[model samples]
Target: MKTMEQIRHLYSRAGFGLRFEDMRLVEQLSVKHSIDFLFRSSVQSKPLVSVKENVNYKDFLKDDQLSRKMFMMQQRQQEKDLNIEWLKNMSTGNTQLRDKMTLFWHNHFACRTLNAWYAQQLNNIQRDNALGNFRTLLLEVSKTPAMLQFLNNQQNRKGHPNENFAREVMELFTIGRGNYTEQDVKESARAFTGWGFNKDGVFAERKFLHDDGQKTFLGNTGNFTGEDIIDMLLAKKQTAHFICTKLYKYLVNEVPDAANVNAMADVFYNHKYEIKPLLEFVFNAKWFYNEKNTGNLIKSPVEFIVAMNRQFYIDYQNPDIQIQFQRALGQVLFYPPNVAGWPGGKNWIDSSSLMYRLSIPATVLNDGVIDFTGKTDPDDEAFIATARKEKKAVHTRVQTQPDWNKFLSDIPAHTTKKEIAQLVLSPAINSKLLSIINKATDIKTMVIELVSTPEYQLS
Candidate 1:
């Protein structure tokens, strides 16, 4: 791959993206040096906004019904704020590798915590350990109140073991399905009894609730604690393969290649699940920049929105605009549809969603409105409909203003449309896109045309 294309690939997958100047600065570096710089630049995590103001759930229950209702209202808004804060960070934080890995783990260990405090806590865990060991990440995430509460491990007590946590730990988090059986789930649930959190969202154990009896799990017999069960799961080579396979799909291609996955599993397992080494291996491999892998993956909604902001310097005038766009696009941050998180890949686009996705660049840059009323498509005015709201149409005026002057002025006056298209798009501009780009009258028109194409939807 050319230097510019290589840097763009790294930035697109590892980080949200880079601006024209940012891309120019790194395009001269060798791929290895660029990878080093990317990792080095993201060594320190950017600060996250405080999403949890109140953690005293114990005291919260003592309050009257009205007090609880008011508190819940405040909490719900805080959750929304947390959602928007993360997006802004993704757009501007410069901690792309960490943030992107955190996003990967976010879905892998998916937990739909309704409480903002617990959700933020879990989010921190993912961010903090995004490049750390997988064993540590899994153990820490498993113990979080968000995971416990969401998976109902909070209710896993003696005599009545809740197997939801055990089942997901295998089926989703590690080893995948068919590696363990219903009996393993039952035994693991028994081991995890007494694992519950206090009102402060701290891990707490109810000794009386635990069953301290010999349990057989995955062919091992012992009085395994919840932590011990996690260790046992991690000890298996299959766990390494499961995580590497998912990582391969997330960072490389959605379709798994057995050879690549096997090599990844070797590096990941041999390193004792160290995240950095595994990623370094993947990034250093020549195949990572191959045509099939470079621009084939679909960008999630978060990625799509951040790319627009990072590339074009778009500003959202309204607080709820991101969430509204997320809802309309099918991938809302912090709100996974179910425990499996977003299906991703081809699931991100269908007949209805493709129309919305294709229209985002023009809609946001042109200050157009989006009508999420499950109605007709947007027209030439750059909106699904005008400000008029139907009886059931969810409407929001997308208060996005793109700084055309900021982006366009940076480019040299002599730059051609093809060069600009190369900078803006991950995929090489094809005949169709080249035709559209060539028809543009000016830089602003050319850029808008470049980004609005369907090819821009892919990385």
Candidate 2:
């Protein structure tokens, strides 16, 4: 692969896509230097805090007369603001890989919560430990208030053990399904009983409620605790393989390359699940830049929004439009479809969503009309508000200001349409598509036209 192609592919998979500011610097270096640059630059990540004022979560718990309707309204608004803020964060800055990886882990360890404080804490945790260590990330995610409440681990207790938490910890989070048996789930559930959060949202064990009985799990017999079960899961090589394969699908291609994934698995296992090294290995590999793997994967809804914003150097006039786009495209932030998370790949391109996905660039850039007639997420207050506001209107405008001049300044004067297409798209367009793209009068027009096409839907 050429250096530029490799760089674009790496950035697309590693981060979002190459930023205009990084263009000059990246052009001077090879793929290896770019890999080092990306890893080195992401050593520190900025935290996302939508709620500036801290509120005591326990205060709400203590209030006996707190109105349920008022609480739901507050919770929904807080989460909506948070969702938009994170999308805005993802759109700008040098924190592409860090923020992008956080998005990956967000879906990987899916948890839903009404408490915005707990949600913010969990997101920052993912960002902080995104490229650090899988062991640390897994442990922290497993213990978070969001996860505990989402999986009903807070209800787990002796003689009334909730198997929901234990089953997911094994089947979804750590090792994939089939690595353990039903008996393992039952035993592990007993071990995890009494694992609940305190009033302050801290992990606390209800000692009296815990079943401190000796149990056999995954062929090991002992008086195991929840922490012990986690340790045992990490010890299994299959855990590494499961995570690696999933990563391979996300970063490389939807269809995993078994040989390359096995190599990645070895690195992840031997390095004790060090995320940075495993990703470095993948980015450094020649097979990762192969033509077959270049642009086959469809862009997830979040990725599409981020890439568009970055490419245009866009600033949304109404940031709430982000949640609209997300809801329309079938991947709202902070809201996974279920415990298993959003089923990515082709699932992102259903008949309803694909039309909106293709029309997004035009809607955001050209002030074109955008309709949210596809589906409505009743859980999101912002979405419902948007729907109600525009219910009678035929053409609702997407409020965004794209700085095309600033972005166009970054493009070299000598660059060809073909090269520009390669930078914006994954797979090369056909002759007919090229003829269509050639109709644009200027570079900005060409780009706006390109992004509006079906080919631009893939990253």
Candidate 3:
């Protein structure tokens, strides 16, 4: 039998944690076969549907502030709908690796837009290229309306270049900070001028707005276009190493293995930034299964909620509850805190957030109620104002109910409370928590207690 720990680790990193039925199936396969299965399944998954808004841009452009406000409100509603769809996919999508990698890339190439159409387009681009070539992904993202608007690249012109997009492309998205000079940022921004989108949400370059002058970037002199600059950046070995280090920290542990990352970087760079080969190398490495890496990372809000839904089959009668939960936990989908994206790891937890996290299982699974009022950060006045407009009061309760039969049916009769606890939680549970779980009268109570423990926060 595959060890429970190994199965848990595989599912935790490869996708969301597996359900009991999935675990039983996965235990039958060898580790190599399991990894292959995930990649193969991911390759075959379909793309998410694009957002279709009924608002007319021409009408909004006219001199009427009320019409513009209505358009903005429609976009906001569409964004929320997209968020709900994505959550549903993560909870039940057949292709787990695709969803997981899509999330990774979303944070990696973080951008936000008030235009819901552009947001959906960007999301689809990330999903389509999540397991594909990093170079292609990078280029596509740079040309998207959502990214252009978010980074202020639409304002870039021949004589006046905007450095926001160029600076972030290096510091946050690629080679990281300190690897490139400020002069390089200035030159790169010059090359990327005139990159903007039209009203139809299509990328349209304004020829007159582009610089078209010779520039020296990263020790190379040329009349480079935006694409040329991207190629130059990807040509550097530092870019490969930078991406590899991030992948290691995200997929393996917070503290990356230097030698392993170097090897992975070599593979990634040699393969022309194909993401699949690098993922294969990491998953196949024997060191990946080391105990030290298993539970070293804390679960982000998305991972925590998705994993719980995967196991318990939570069905929220109203989709707005998902948004409320995400807001309370401080990781709103598509709406990151800032340009740097969610810090993740330990940043996901504070005293207030932790208590809410711990209370989620009991509140959602047992009582089927969640009070949205006062749970969110009081400082988010914009969100508060929006909530009030939507009539989402403090007394709002989630009409959530768990399908316990689906959860319990997969647990074998011979499995003990401790064994079930091990299956549900990542890392080892503390003695006090274990004692509390052991005192439960049956499997249902044991599960609720186990999920309530701090150990459940790790994976």
Candidate 4:
């Protein structure tokens, strides 16, 4: 049987872990209640972010090089601000499963924002659909203006259809590679030709641009629509296995045994692709909290920082410093390095990035001050408050330094430095980390040193 503490650790590393109070709540609840809460709490649509809308999408294509570059830069800064604000709510908000599901879906249908406004919009959409029906998410993603533009679906039309979105939908999103053929992609491309967005960023099916000809997809011949193509793809058992394998790697262990994966796929497929059912079955499963899985994985940069901030009640008005640190730490806002998104876990640690991760807390809680240019104001406290208040607001700045002593005051005094190491370290305490924590005289130093460890990368 999994102990409560071990279960909490599993949940933490699997998602953002738990808040201190949440940990207490989970401790008190029956496993069924605890599991049910994960799904029930996530059933609502996330509140929309408040960003400056009515943007002219055409202005981005200005002929002047300087003007375009300036526009791109401003847009990038705005996206960073938006991301920082979202992070604050994600870390501190009342709803736990919503943020966790948002994180999961962001990786599921990963798209990067080249423009800040577009990225901010994309981020909000992902949050809105985080806990909705899987079919709804897939359909929403297909029509999302940001996705349509990012994957070049805007160029997909009657005569010359771009197959980028179609290829990804089959290969990356639904079924794994090689489950479908080149002919399937070509046919799917034809079906999705008219799936695009209007000027106001809403879905539009342009009949004039649509390929109305019959398409032979997966041995089925018909004048299939884009929705039909998706429906056909989901009917395959491979889609279930592909998604289950991903969930296993993320929520269970990185290296899932084949037997477990097959079982998960069976449950997922039988459940009609409702994500909550699969997850509840997994979290409630006896093997989910096994010793081999507990604290064995590493946290992604966003998860690492957000969990810590929430646990300590660490608030930042000016997320620029944190944002700069995030960039330095190899996971920048609005920009994913490529289409596949961040590899995450152990991949988040490298020689250059590791040093920056170790150094970030000091930067935020001590002497670090982020430089601001353009219209962004880090000194505006109201902006910071707005930014952190469950929705969109400009990021704020911190005039006072963080107090480490007060930060760990709530942790039991009876707790040893080793226990503190275990509480935060992702991969548990290896000798190097154990040595560092052992040498520390007090909880504050031990906390910092443990975070600075190689093991800390796992949290």
lDDT of candidate 1? 0.84
**In model 3, where is the ten-residue run with the lowest total lDDT?**
375-384
What lDDT does candidate 2 reach at residue 384?
Answer: 61
TM-scores for every predicted model: 0.93, 0.94, 0.94, 0.86
Task: Rank candidates, lDDT, best first.
Answer: 2, 3, 1, 4
**Per-residue CA lDDT of candidate 2, range 123-161, in tens?**
999999999999899888888888999999999999998
lDDT of 4 at 380: 40
The local lDDT score (0 to 100) that residue 441 gets in candidate 3 is 90
For model 3 the local lDDT of residue 392 reads 49
Model 4: C-alpha RMSD to truth?
6.6
Write one digit per residue (lDDT tens) for candidate 1, span 63-117: 9988886776676688789888888887777778998998999899888866788
Q: Which has the greatest TM-score?
A: 2
Residue-level lDDT of model 3, residues 50-151, one tens digit each, is 476534466669758877777766767787898888989999877898998898888888787766778788888999999999999999999999999899
Candidate 4 whole-model C-alpha lDDT, 0 to 1: 0.71
Superior by TM-score: candidate 2 or candidate 4: 2
The collision pairs in model 1 are: none
Candidate 4 clashing pairs, residues 3+ apart or interchain: 12-17, 298-458, 317-396, 317-397, 318-396, 318-397, 426-458, 426-459
What's the C-alpha lDDT at position 352 in model 3? 79
What ordering of candidates by TM-score runs from best to worst? 2, 3, 1, 4
